[model samples]
Structures are given as structure tokens and as C-alpha cells.
Target: MSTSSEHTFTSPFRNFSREEWKRLNGQLSHSIREEDLDQLHALNEPLTMQEIEEVYIPLAHLLELHISKFQELHASSNEFFKRNHQKLPFIIGIAGSVAVGKSTTARVLKKVLALLPSKPKVELVTTDGFLYPNKELIKRDILNRKGFPESYDTKKILRFLADIKSGKSQVTVPLYSHLEYDVLPNEKLVISQPDVLIVEGINVLQVNSRKNGVFVSDFFDYSIYVDADEKNIVSWYINRFESLRATAFQNSASYFHKYANLTTEESLAMAINIWNEINKPNLHQNILPTRYRADLILKKSAQHFVKRIKVRKI
Candidate 1:
């Protein structure tokens, strides 16, 4: 028998094959250029216009439908209360294993959703900014557990989400640098009442016990979990590490610059070790457990193309 991780299309989700999903694209055309896509995707992940047409077009339409409904409901609530409050930004949370392309998904969605007829102001932020600084992690001795749930400042994250949800203006979020592998000092992203906000991170869907019973996923209007086999994810992680070694790691300022001069075999071994010791266990223990919690799951093939979509049934 297949396990839950196998995603055999059990209850609560309506599963669609790639062909079925693509048929829902329904003549929608986007103006995204090839050069624009190059800047959107992550290293080692290739996103083509064809994939955008087949997968993201329909997905964007679906989100617009949800957004429209949300607007209607908000107006109705205001009518009932005889009060007109500012509309809160719709928050979307995207979660998946590292190197599984969740960032690419979030970026593409942000672009597509913003280009819709409504032309709503859309913004994207990653929860990496919420992680404790490397210094604090080292002080706490959880630097090795960087991506784990405990490494994040949950209280601060909750406050940020709460502020945004309350329709606060000019909320500031910390900035993190992938090149330096740390939260940048004194730099922040200021959000000012955007129409939509996309929060992407592996830990977005995580639900550890809290005193006030608030969780990060609680603020999400919609959530997506990028899904793939553990073996495929492991392969992708290794390949990404190898690619980084040749590129980003060679930079003197890169945190992993020490691995830049390693031989091919040595680099491969190091990638395997990091995946086995760090990313793999975190996937199984923290990330994978939250998969089903997502409202939608974008299941991908070994080639990194989305092959199937499972959307929660209303």
C-alpha cells in the first residue's frame, strides 16, 4: 500500500492530470517574455513559457476567482455592519522542500496575478527574513538547525502577519541575503497595503503549539505546497548545491565559498552529505508533514515540471 507521502489522491482534494489541468487554461494569454522568465527562476531550475501557459495560466484564473469571491464577501460584511473598512491584502503562503522550486512558483504567480485585468498590486516576500540572524543562531547553538521551525522568530512573524492583516500601512520586514547566508543588517522590505502578498518559505505551513494558538498558516488566504518524491527532491538539492559551487560559491562573499575549489567528486560528496544530514531530515520531520495542510498541491515530475495538481474541494 502507498503511504500518505505517495499522494494517491485521497479525500478532500480534487486531483487533475496535466492534460486535464491545461484544458482549463481557457484561451487566457499572458504577455510574459522569455527574457523576463530568465530573471524569475532560481538557479538550476528552468521555467519555460510552455509550462507557464499549461500550468500557471489556469492557476492564475483560479486564484482570480477566489479573489473575486473574497471581495464580494468583504463588501457584504461591510453592508451588514454598516461600516466601510479598508480591504485587507490577500495573503498567499507557498511551502515546499528546499530546491523544490517554491520560490519560482511564488514569483511566477506574483507576476501573472499582477498582470490580470484587475492589475492589482501584488508583492512577494520569503520567510527566510523571519529566521534568526546567524549570530543569534550560533548563540543559541541552533545554527546547524537553521531551517528548522525553532530557528524562526515566531513571535515576530506573528506580529508582522497580524499587522498586515489589520490593514496597517508601511509594515517593515527584515531582509535576508542568500549570498551571505544571513539576515542583512539594517535593511528591510516595507509593505504598504498591497492588494496581494505572497509569502514563500518551507516553514509557512508548519504548526507547532503556541501559547496564543496562532500559527503562520492562520493568516494565509490560500496556501500551495509544491510536491515531489523525496528522492527527486534530494537529487534536485544536490544538483543545486553543485551548481552553486560553480557559481555563487566562487564569490568571495558567498557563505559557502570554502567549497568553491573542491574537485567534482569532492563537491558531489559534500552536497550529498549536506542533503543527508540537514535538508533531508528537515523535509521528513518538518516540511513534508505539512503538505496536506495546503489548499493546493502542485505535484512535479523529475524534470521539475508540474505534472498534476490537487486542489482542496470546497
Candidate 2:
């Protein structure tokens, strides 16, 4: 991969500058609108049409090619077996640190993929739902390590992926509420047949040992990692937390409602403490180690804009 500051010939990834990657878009055009941007972007993260056209549109095109190849392979396998069967949804996993804007990428990619020529039905699900509820986390005494790999229900996540890949007609996933900071009891996300399923979360790319050695990433057709410097990500996290304190946290029902009343100095101190105590350690120990496991990596600038992309060699 060649970036402005680095070049390597034997790396597993081929790096592309933003301009080079944008050229891959060719004649492709997106259907994203202004209002769509409002709904797609994460709080305190800036996503411009330029970013979509240059970064995500090209990414969507690449995924479309991958999806086509995936379908062809499935059909070939079916013919080889002398059997006819429905093709499972192509699952794409997006992973990154807490404030790296992976959610925006997943949401934007889903919108773009759906608007493709085939108009395939694309569904987005975050692994947050698979996280143990707050009560369960407290019971396990890992509430402070919420985003760590151990905080997730590995067994349930593996089962969910297995069911989707098996072409199940109906499968349900638990629903997680960010405002409440918990997995809602009895609420679920019903996933029917989708042409594409995007699973986004910080833990998606982690290597895990399950029964028979099946990993959560085993079911993914493609995976992406959003990357940035630790200092930049820490800044972004603090910024998002401060923004939430002014908005969502102001609500009485918000899990972090108490933070809304904090003075600027107090909020800054608290955000830093949370990052140092929880997020920073998790990033270094778990998330950063999985970056190489992704098929593609979006390396972002300090401003949270993806400046370069690294694609794993075929």
C-alpha cells in the first residue's frame, strides 16, 4: 500500500490514495440526498457528499462486484451438488473503534448498495444487540469493559450468523437502545430474506474460538475496518460525548443524563477518564489487533474523513 507518508511493495494490502480510489467509481453515481446525509451521519462526525462519492460510492461498487462473485460461486456449488437452493444474503461486517464513524459507513453503504441496478434488499444490523444487557454486564462484573470481546454473547452471535447463512426464512435478533444504554427486553429485530446483510460493531472482527472453532467472522462475505490514530480517535470520542451531553444526555430518560449537568471541565475530565479506563485499553488490547483481519481498511484523517483505503490482495 502506498500512502503520502509510506510505501510498501510486499504488504498484504494494496494502498490507494483518495484520488486513486475515487477513480474506481467510473460512471457510478449515488442517490444520496441532503436529508439522507442527516439520517446517515453519526453525531459529531462530518460526512460530505464528496466523502460518499469519493470513498463510499467506490466502496459500494467494489462490494457490488464482490456480491456478484459471491452469488456466482454459490450457484456453481449448487450445480456441482446437483441441487437447487436459495442463496444466502451476502454478509458484510464493519468494525472499528467507538468513535471512528463505522456506523456512518455501514449505513451509507447499505443505502448505496440498495440503490444499485439490481435494487437488492439490504439490511443493516449492529452487534450492539448481541451485547449482554446492562444488568447482565453488571452481573458478569464487566460493565466497565462493555465494548470488549468478552462483553458480547459469542455463542448467540455465532448462532445468529449461522441461521442467516443457512437461508432461514425468519430470524430475530435482540434490539439494543443507545438512549437507554441497554438491550431492550423482549424487543427484537426480525430479519427476513435480504440480498445483503451488514453487521456493524466494534467487536465484529475479533478472532474468537467457538464450538468447532467457528469464529463470528467465518460467516462474513466481506469485512471492513475503520482506522485512525489513537489520539485522533480519543479526541473524536470526547467530542461525541460532549455533544451527547448537550443533546441526548439532556433527556431525562438517557442513561447518561447526569452528564448533561456537568460543567465543561467536569465533562472533559469524565470523558477522558472513561477513555483512559475503558475505551483506550480495549482499542489497544482488542480492536487494533483485528485491523489486519479485515478485507478492507478505511484509514481516516484527524478530521474523521477517510483519506486512504487499504484493500487486501486477492
Candidate 3:
């Protein structure tokens, strides 16, 4: 692994080696049990207890520090205005390439943050839910570009974030199903006011100029970008695809059921093709470019453990 000192002059972040980062854990204690980790782990991406202690515990503690500061700022602003103000959720955006484990990171943070002494309500939502339905994608003839920025319902996502940031009491988000591989019709996830909201997706860090206005990252209080070498991420994606083929794709109604009967060789070939044709291009063109926008970046090793953390310099 390269040392942070090597990149100090060029990088926007002050990189911390794993050992240096772990020491930041200090006296903080976590309640993340093995069972909690089991549920949070994504397909083919397992997080060990040691990794959780070293990486996530310190990250969560940093978040608590940010949240406390935000609360104090909010209170001071209210005092200056001489008006009673409602507390809005502190929004956190998590972005990364497909199969880089952003989902697992989001789930872990939600669970860990909820267990904090504050015991504040926490909610997790994925931008996958804001993707246009399969029908809409087919109509646009962009089904092959499903994860690209153009394939998302960007306007709707902006509105949703706007509503949340405006302190709406309740907001409803569409639901997406991985097995069905599309947005579920007429299904919605309603989120009431929460103390913290984690929005995870490939494009959460992307900034767009809308005809209405610029929206998206402006609403985020903090953001994270999970990162790894492209080769490593591709390997993880292929492994995950194989795992899904053996499990979810085995279901008769699974959208990817056709892959279940493929020979091991055929499965690996198809996964590689999917990576080359779709996922890889999407990561390079859309996802990777937005990584520098994140407040922090979690760089992973080939084994999928976070080897270093890059905190944007103040």
C-alpha cells in the first residue's frame, strides 16, 4: 500500500493509513453485534468485526461530532432569527461505483448511528428507488444504460431531496426490487422526520444543472464515496453476480432467472461481458468523476477491507 505522504501535495484529502485511522477510535464503544453485521453485509461482500471496529467505528464517531456541531449551528441561527425553528434531518449521501459496497456501508452507518447515545431516529434510502421503471427505460430505449445518470429520474430525486431538506413531516419514495430488477409499481417507502438520513447510490455525488435550478449535493450535510481500484471492483461485481445467480436468480420469478442455469464458465463470461459493456463504462464516465466531491472517501483493498480513509482537508 502507498503511504499518504506520497500523495499529500496532489490530493485534496489528508489520507490516513489504516493503522493511523484506527487510533482515532479512541474511547468510543460500538454496539454492532455479529448478528447486526450479518444483516448489513451485502451479497459476496462480508465485513468482519475487526474491519467494523477499525473503519466504521471511527467513521461513526466523526459523524456524531459533525451532527452535534450542526445542531449547535441550527440552534444559534434560530436564536438570531428570534423564531422557533423545526429541526431538519442531517442528510448524508453515500456514493460509489456499482458493487463497491456503498449499500453495506449505508446500512452499517444507519444501524450504528441509531445506537448512539442520542438514539436519534435514522433512515436509509437508496437512489435506486428513484430510477425510472423498466417500462420507461424500454420506452426510452436506454435499458442498457440503467445505472447511468441519464437513466435516473433526476428531477424527481431533486424534488424528493428538496422536500426532505425543507423539513417536510413525511415524504414518500418509490420502492425498487433487485429480484424484479425494476421499480415496484405503486409501492412507496414513507419516511417521517428522522434525525439522520443516509442516501446511497452511484450518482449521489453527481452535480447537475437543471432548467429549474442546481439541486442535489447542495442538500447534503456530509457525503462519502467508497472507492477501490477498477479491477478490484470489477472482480467484486463478477463475484456478486455469481452469488446472485446461485441464490436470487434461482427463483422462478427472478428477473435474472435465465442466468441461474448457466454453466460456471458461461456465468463468468457473461459477468465479465456485463462489466465491460455496462458497469465499467458507467463507473468510469459517471461515478469516478464525482468521487472528489465527497467529504470523505473510503478506499478499499482487493480483499474489500478499507485500507485507508481520505478526509477532505478543512
Candidate 4:
């Protein structure tokens, strides 16, 4: 129940102030442009160029180092085996609460990493794609629990990661449409063997509750948790809902079209209701507990700018 700032810990993470973190960006060239930010920003979530330079540039550099290290380790293992082995993509897991802007972090990292000198291929996939189809959820009467872990096909996701780590040439994942708010039947995203793959979702950091089970994060070489105060996240979620009401929800085919014509007051009421009933409960019960599992934590200010970072101490 304690706020992020109020919570004290004797954990392995070392906290760095924003200024301290920025100093780590030394001599790293900024390759991201305004257009890139525009594309990466989620609804009602604006990312400033300064924030990207100060926060994400350094993050990209750190990831680059991890990728390089992973490659070297893989090569050493292959040499020890005296056999040629295919290089597998370095998987990065990004997790956070519902409105914490993890997707933007993932997309920005993908673009920046691709532009690095190595020109490594980077593909981004979201756990949303692994959610069971709406029809299946309805059939199971778990439609209200759509974003919960139980609603996801974890076995399938595990198999997908297994194939990727096994050096499969091509892997296909189901595509989920935000506009439709459902998994598109028969549509899949094809990911060729890449140098890096970023998986973003609200629950990516969660460990299986059952003992003696593996977690999706076990496959990740590095992981990030985008974090913010619960109050700020609730506000952001309402703002995003309002924005979607005016935009995507206006489409007749949109899943939330019923809310398109709602008055501002009504929209706000509904947003608050959804947050209290679903998102907040989910965050406290499932998401926040897993925050400690991440290799890096990007803690955000009320304005959504990353104010500090907590890196897991080696």
C-alpha cells in the first residue's frame, strides 16, 4: 500500500538520480528524430526530445552493451562445443502498469538500437498478441479478466520463445488489434531471426505463481520496468481513455465505440470506474509485485518523464 517513494528496500538495485543517469549518456550520439518520437508516443503520452536524450539514449547504450556481451558469450559456448551455432536474438522484456508508457520505451529502444553502428536487426512484439481471442474469453466467461495472466496463452508464448532461442529461422506470433480490441484471427506477425527482440507488456516481469515453473522473463537477457506513482498512472489512464474516446472510439467498428459520444463528465466517470474496478486491482495484485524482477527500472515523474533509474547491481 505504500507509495513508490515511501517504500524502502534492501534490494540489489542501485538508484541513480536523473542527472546521474544522464552523465552515463556521455559521447553517445543521438540518432532519434522528432518523427520517431511522434510515432512512438502513445495516446496522450507525449515524450519530449530532451527526455529521450536524457533518459532513453543512455538506456539504449546500456542495452547495446548487454547485446554485445550476450553475443560474445554465445560465441564462446559454440567454440567450446566445437560446433557452428546460429546466433539467437537477444530478448529484452519490458514490463509496467497499464498506463506507464512501456510501449513507447520499447519502440524507441528498437529504433535507436537498429540505428547503432552494428545495424542489428531489432523486432518488437507485445504480450497483447498472446492474449486469448475475445471469443474464447467470452466462452470461458472471463471476458472481464481479459488482461489478467489467466487470459493469456502462456504455453504458446513459451513455445514461441523456445523456438526463437532454438534458432528458428522464422517465428510467427498472433497479432492483436487495439482498434478492434481483439486478437485478429488468422493474422500473424512474422519475425525473422533478429539480433534483438523486445517484448513489452503489463505483466512481462511476472513469475509463475506455481513453484518449480519457469517465467517468460527467464528467456530475457535484460529487462526494464517502467514505473510511476499509482496516482499519476491512474490519471494517465483516464487521459488516454478520453483521447481514445475522441479518436479510435469514434470509429463505428471500434470496440469501444459506445463511449465515443459520451460527454466529458461521463467519459471521465467511466474511465475512473474502469481504473478502480480493473486496472488498479490488477496493478497492485499482479504487476507491482514483479517490479523487483527487472534488471532496470525507469521511475517516472508525474509528467511521465523518467526522473530516475534503478539498476540491479551485479
Model 3 CA deviation exceeding 4 Å by range: 1-10, 27-30, 209-211
TM-score of 1: 0.95
lDDT at residue 209 of model 3 (Cα atoms)? 23
Candidate 3 structure quality by residue, lDDT tens digits, 185-286: 889999999999999999887765242666578889999999999889989998999988899999999999999999989999999999999998888888
Q: How well is each residue in 1-314 modelled by candidate 4, as lDDT tens digits? A: 86887777577999999999999983444466677778988877888888878888788888888999999999999999997989999999999999899988888888778877788999999999999999999999988887888888888888888899999999999999988999998899999999999999987777752223878888889999999999999999999999999999999999999999999999999999999888888898889999988999999999989998999998
Q: By descending lDDT, how would the candidates be arranged?
A: 1, 2, 3, 4
Weakest 10 consecutive residues of candidate 4 by summed lDDT: 203-212
Taken over the whole model, the C-alpha lDDT of each candidate is 0.91, 0.91, 0.89, 0.88
> For model 4, how many clashes?
0
Model 4 alpha-carbon drift over 4 Å, by segment: 1-9, 28-30, 209-212
The local lDDT score (0 to 100) that residue 269 gets in candidate 1 is 97
Location of the lowest summed lDDT over 10 successive residues in candidate 1: 25-34
Window of ten residues with lowest summed lDDT in model 2: 1-10
Candidate 2 Cα lDDT to native = 0.91
Q: Count the clashes in each prediction.
A: 0, 1, 0, 0
| Cand. 3 Cα-lDDT | 0.89
TM-score of each prediction: 0.95, 0.95, 0.94, 0.94
State how far residue 62 of model 1 sits from its true place (Å): 0.3
Candidate 4 global TM-score: 0.94
RMSD of 1: 3.5
Number of the predicted model whose lDDT against the real structure is largest? 1
